[model samples]
Target chain A: MKIGIIGATGKSGSKIVTEALNRGHQVTALVRNKDKATKLFGGTVTIIAKDAFDITKQDLTNLDVVIDAFSVPLGKHLAYQHIDLAVHLVHLLRETETPRLVFILGAGSLQTDDGLLLDQLKKIPDSQAWIDTPESQTHELDFLRTVTNVNWVGVSPAASFVDGPKTDYALGKDHVLYDANQKSEVSTGTMAVAILDELENPSVHQARFTIRNK
Target chain B: MKIGIIGATGKSGSKIVTEALNRGHQVTALVRNKDKATKLFGGTVTIIAKDAFDITKQDLTNLDVVIDAFSVPLGKHLAYQHIDLAVHLVHLLRETETPRLVFILGAGSLQTDDGLLLDQLKKIPDSQAWIDTPESQTHELDFLRTVTNVNWVGVSPAASFVDGPKTDYALGKDHVLYDANQKSEVSTGTMAVAILDELENPSVHQARFTIRNK
Candidate 1:
């Protein structure tokens, strides 16, 4: 299958690229920093150097799935790009079914017994600086929910997303996922594997799903 | 004030362009069809030919206000362009306060005595074929209300938005506006006048307002 990974040099993106390549799918790293992307992939991947918002449909043509693994560190002034980029990509794909989009969103939009996870995060210590990304991402999913003409799905990692290796994954929907001991976590490798698995075998449609390392 | 009107050849836009000109404000008509727009304005208005979705900040740089009066005939195909174009324009002005945007929205998003006006519109016979435009525009407003950084203000005409000459106008917020006769209606001329008044006076900010023929 043909695939494009936006922000493919980032943590989750690099893992997804590796997982996709290991499964023999052709991967194109759609990125802005060609030097960093080339260094990260060691010239093993195809590259398209352009800002995500500037990416045109012609650049997206011939792909089966476009994984939006784009991310910025939390608290960045430009955190709103998370929502802006999602809307830009959706606008490009309107009224089309090909090149299914997979968005990597945060858990803020997920519903818990209390309410939205975003509400809970706001109450945490020093969440102000980092909460904008989650708020913007939650808004991204909200915007995506209103769009039906495009083929799109969103994936959210567990509450404690970390940089680590893959594990057997547990998939859930619209809630904070937890293990028996109430531990909620998902490593980048586990997220990549679960995402690749979903891309290979389509399950959910026009909705988001959550994954946890099990 | 220097104002730019998207869809300046359309019913509402043409009127707004004329109103802005009559009020002594410089106006630019950002439109798709150059010939039609030139025929409409007769060389009185400056014209920038391009699809609304393709409009860039460079084209809008010097404008003090951008009136997004772009609309499709009720029930037209590709109605989702309403939301897509709004998203595109907002993305262009993200994190900036300049170029205060004025969106001409449908009354479907307004509140009714029972619930959202869109709920009532959905029950109308054969609404499926034409409801997409209002639905998308309502979603457009929803998306805009979520934005905080951009200087955006939306205006929804009354329940019965018709094309006619200007009359005494009354402005309200959120709810569908009605006159003493219990008639909820607004002419394109009235809408244009109210918009120009708002642009010159800067009444509303980051929220939506409604207008009706009084």
Candidate 2:
């Protein structure tokens, strides 16, 4: 499978590229800087040097999947670039034979007992920069659902994600997964594994899934 | 005014220190690490070392105001610590002459259009991690309202915050603040200004305020 990653130089995207390559999949890294891409990801994967929104119009439909591991840095433009890229990718995917689109979403859109989009992020402290992304991502997800015949999966990480080993964590649907004490935690590696595995299994088709370590 | 700040090492706490000092208020930084206390913030500010939970027994009742900037890294722990710390702070504040106990809360407690707590966050694309802290911050806000005499103010940040300059943001009551286009963004500096201003003015006393950049 030839996969195109939108933010391949980011922390999460770099891992996604590594995992995709380890699985023997042909990977294309879409990034703004080739030097940073070379420094961060080495030479194992092919690189696409373009802004997230301005990729050369190729037949992206022939690709197996497009994983948006792209993350806008803390002080960059709000979810502006992210939404633009996702919408463009959706349009590009519509032209391709690719059957699935997987996005690495933040955990902000989950519901509490009150059933409101948890837009008021207070619990997962380290990822406060993500607080704004969910509101825009929610808009993007809403847009994606309106499009017909494009299968999409939004994979949100747990409340706390540390850069660590792959723990092969469990997955939860609709509800935020909590441990025995009802705490939610996951590693970035395990989250990448879950998304990639779902790409192969299709259990979480057209739905959002959360990953957490017990 | 002599002010004591718990969680002085956190984003909110550091701001409290800066704001209080900038306003010519005598400030004390209550932290867990003495070395980081000297490095991150300098020595002119008095540094008191203690666990967040242990502050209840400290002689904080004499200070003009006690701001529990102390927050568990939402990504590191669920809202358990936040709830526990708030509950304890409320009880301790009741014993002191200080009339106000300001809490930096998560946006999960804010009421949505449906009049429910926006606790579910996984549905949102980028904020999955905040489900824990925001949910817990909501609980703390509710608990603060039940107490008498000790005025509590819960300050929830808008969608995204970064190391940006203070842009003179606006304040919303019980609802999330939005820009002209309804998108929410706030600089940490402006959030600090709003919070410290609230501390002096006492508007929205015994309630919560959501802040976003203009």
TM-scores of the candidates in the order shown: 0.98, 0.48
Quality of candidate 1's docking, in CAPRI categories?
medium
lDDT of each: 0.92, 0.70
Per-residue C-alpha lDDT of model 1 across residues B10-62, encoded as one tens digit per residue: 98998898888898998899999999998888878889999988899899889
Quote the lDDT for A128 in model 1: 95
Task: Report the error of model 2 at residue A53, Å.
Answer: 58
Q: What's the TM for model 2?
A: 0.48
The reply for model 2, stretches above 4 Å from the true place, is A1-214, B95-99, B114-117, B125-130
Q: Each candidate's root-mean-square deviation in Å?
A: 1.0, 18.1
Error of 1 at A188 (Å): 0.5
Where is model 1 chain A poorest over a 10-residue stretch in terms of lDDT?
A: A37-46
Off by over 4 Å in 1: none
Q: What is candidate 2's lDDT per residue for B80-156, written digit by digit as tens?
A: 56755775566555534464677887767766675644644546776656566666666567656544446677788
Task: Tell the DockQ for candidate 1.
Answer: 0.69
Highest TM-score model number: 1
